[model samples]
Target: MPATPSTILVVEDDDIVRMLIVDVLQELGFSVLEADGSARAIELLEDTNQRIDLLMTDVGLPGMDGRALAQKARELRQSLPILFASGYADTVEVEEGMAIIGKPFSIDQLRDKVKSMLGI
Candidate 1:
């Protein structure tokens, strides 16, 4: 039997960027859940019983930033893989065991990074 597609929770404040990421992840055969900010993302995380394989979020977000969100998410789901997307590379530091993809990344780059993180 084939394994189920990994579910990724994407938290991006920009609408266009979030749409693009969702489209790419869907096309790449992974299930995607999108949120425009940290609050919504946390709501989804708290409400879902399904297994989420990854959390891809922007470093800058309104209300609760991505780093705070990632920390909260890890509390909810231990050792959840995270990919922090940021346009400001100089300000963003990649955490241990967590992945970071700069903004304006190509579809292949996003797919490759997610695949490597998920061990797909």
Candidate 2:
């Protein structure tokens, strides 16, 4: 049997960027959940019973930030992979089991990075 498509929770404050990311991930055949900020992302993480394969978040969130969100998310799901997207690459540190995708990424770049992270 074919493997199930992985579900990714995307946390980004920018509405247009978040929508674009959701569309891209969906087009690439991955399930996606979206949040406008860290609080909502954490709320979703705490509330959902569904399996979330990855957490993709922006580094510069309005509150709590992506690193903190990732930490909390790991507490909720220990093995969940994280992908950090940022415009300020110099300031963001990449953690273990985490990948970084720079902002202004093309569809192919995002698709490839996500696929590699998920090992699909």
Candidate 3:
């Protein structure tokens, strides 16, 4: 039997960017959940029934920001994997267990990084 596709929660402030990412991820055979900002993302994260396998968030988000959101998420789901998408990827530093991907990444790069993180 085939394994179930991993579910990724994508938190991005840009509507078009988020849509493109969601489309690309869905096309690549992964289940995707999207949130425009930290508030909605937190609501989704708080939902116990949701099986979120990974969190891919933009680092330059408004209000709470991606790092803060990741910290809050960890409080709720300790083992959750976080992937920060940043425009300044080379300079971005993540926590020991977290990862980073540069902004304007190619479809292939995004796919590879996400799959590698999820081990899918």
Write candidate 1's Cα lDDT for 1-120 as tens digits. 127889999999999999999999999888899999999898888875866889999989988999999999888877889999988856777666588998889999999999889877
The per-residue C-alpha lDDT of model 3 at residue 26 equals 94
**lDDT values of the candidates?**
0.89, 0.89, 0.94
**Best candidate, TM-score-wise?**
3
Among these predicted structures, which one has the highest lDDT? 3
TM-scores, all candidates, are 0.92, 0.93, 0.96
The superposed Cα distance between candidate 2 and the true structure at residue 30, in angstroms, equals 0.8
lDDT of 2 by residue, 1-120 (tens): 127788889999999999999999988888899999999898888976876888999988987999999999989888889999999766777778998899889999999999888887
Per model, state how many residue pairs clash.
0, 0, 0
Q: Which ten residues in a row have the lowest lDDT in candidate 1?
A: 88-97
Off by over 4 Å in 2: 1-3
